[model samples]
Target: MSWMLILIYACVFALTCGFSYWALTGLMPSGMTQRLDSLKDTPHFVLTEPSARWQRWRDKLQRALSWLGPLSSATEPEDASHTFSSRLRFYNAGIHSHLAPLVYLASKTVLTFALPSIAIGVLWYSQVSLSQAPGMALVLVFAMLGYYLPNAILAHRVARYQQALFNAFPDALDLMRVCVQAGLGLDAAIDRVGHEMHLSCPELSNEFELTGLELRAGASRADALRHLSARIGLEDVEALVVMLIQADMLGTSVHESLQVHSESLRTKRRLLAEETAAKLPIKLLIPLVFCVFPALLTVLLGPAVISVHEILAPTAQGA
Candidate 1:
């Protein structure tokens, strides 16, 4: 029995080590790293510090893990549709990786198996005598939780990204209005705004930069604007895109349109802020009732209750 336990431990350790090695090697940026290596003898080549080296390793690990992506056994048509939806989710989350869907799926698969395996190992090591049926059921529950965890995290990221973009859009639009009023064309204004907003609103800046790149790459203005709206997945941004497209088609005054749009965005932002503030008390009510009130009541009543109990005990003794 001892030998069997030892063998199990050894097998688990070996499997873990093997997987780690495979992941590391698979994730390494061979093309980029090799190019760097070839350039190492050049005068301009600066050696990376230990921290930079570590960062590179960490980035590679992330990329590798992401590459494991979703598994699709559907027909080509179905797979394509699935991929499209997955891609949209990745885009919404600000994950630009071509393999994001696959990586997400892979992560889900790995966690679903890995978490339950770890749970079982720990249970066994602790010698918990769970019946086979119950034990398997617990493992399945763990697996299901693990499977959904990635999706939850991705959704959270997307929400955060959208909120950031939404908050930044009004400011960006105002800046664009200024640039347009100053005689910069739409393209130049976008590029200028992207550069200026980099420190303040990196997400918006990146989207603008990508739009600029698309335009430069020969995409039509309408198509590029549509793509930007699609990538952002925000109603406000979609409205802005539609407005810009209309302004272009109708040969309207870009500067005037931009100014109107900026004001509209500012009004929308203020409304959202007021709405959130209005809900704040309601949101806090649950904690105040369930947590704070209980603690306060305990502190306020505890001594009185103890005093009453003492008084009653002495009276009963005297009687």
Candidate 2:
């Protein structure tokens, strides 16, 4: 038994498990911490200052992986950061961090080797090498699964976040329309809507609120709208962004554009609701067939089958 190899394997396994567990079961910030994320807050300052032993270690590990962000971009210099960076993906999933890409890249690196190391160690322990078909196949399968698992998790996160945003957007849009009709500017309407939606739809509210901040900070309306669409990564939002941009450029009525867009979004939302309702029966059928129907058949036929068996068995035995 090689102690060094065993130690390396253990380290890799620990790192992989820690990252995956953290990604799946995220740390929940308190309500006040989440809402007020400023550096002056108690929790934020505590995390910022390396007073705790764990904080010091975490900061060291983060510095080690921080290089991967630039490495990811350097690997695809011709493309935009959003094209090659996991930043947009993380943003859409509500993970706003400069270190997210680094963590993601490090996870891929660890997982790419972690499973294969375990498999190869097992093969070696069994006196088999990768030259053999079974060993090679096992290593390949583990490696592929390791590499793709992060991607699947990210997609699931994005899907769930997007669903929440989609469900919440209509009401926010209606509020924006009302504000616009009341003679408020688009920026003011966005700010008011975001502030109003704090209780109902915080995620979308945060995005809208950020957009309004960018507007107040003197960013162009088009740029701010595009940022909103990119952060959301939703087709409906992209469409709205395009419409708003076009309206702004053409000097058309922003309220009219919003009104029409709001109605279209409502129609789409209703249709999506109908589609989901239609899918309910099909989704329920599998459980009915496999679970419910078996119990139902057992209840309905068990007594009859038992009676017939009793009657026929006695006659057959007597005869």
Give the winner by TM-score. Answer: 1
RMSD of each: 10.0, 7.3
lDDT top scorer: 2
lDDT of each: 0.81, 0.82
Give the alpha carbon lDDT tens digit for every residue of 1-319 in model 2: 4434644775798899999988766766665565666534344212244459877877888998876545534544555765645578888997886667778877776787898998898778867767867668778878997878888999999999899899888888889989989999888999999888876777888899889989999999999999999999999999999998998788898887887888888899899899999999999999999999999999999999999999899899999
lDDT for each residue of candidate 1 in 1-319, tens digit (9 for 90 to 100): 2434644765798799999999999988775476567657764314455698887976787777654542422212456776677688888888897656656777787888898897688658756544666556667777887888988999999999999999999889889999998999998898889888865777888899899989899999999999999899999889889999999999999888888888898898899899999999999999999999999999999999999999899899999
Tell me how far the alpha carbon of residue 25 in candidate 2 is from the true structure, in angstroms, after superposition: 9.9
TM-score for each candidate, following the candidate numbering: 0.75, 0.71
Model 2, residue 290: distance off in Å is: 1.8
| Model 2, runs deviating above 4 Å | 1-58, 66-85, 116-139, 306-319
Candidate 1 stretches greater than 4 Å from native: 1-77, 126-134, 317-319
In model 2, what are the clashing residue pairs, if there are any?
none
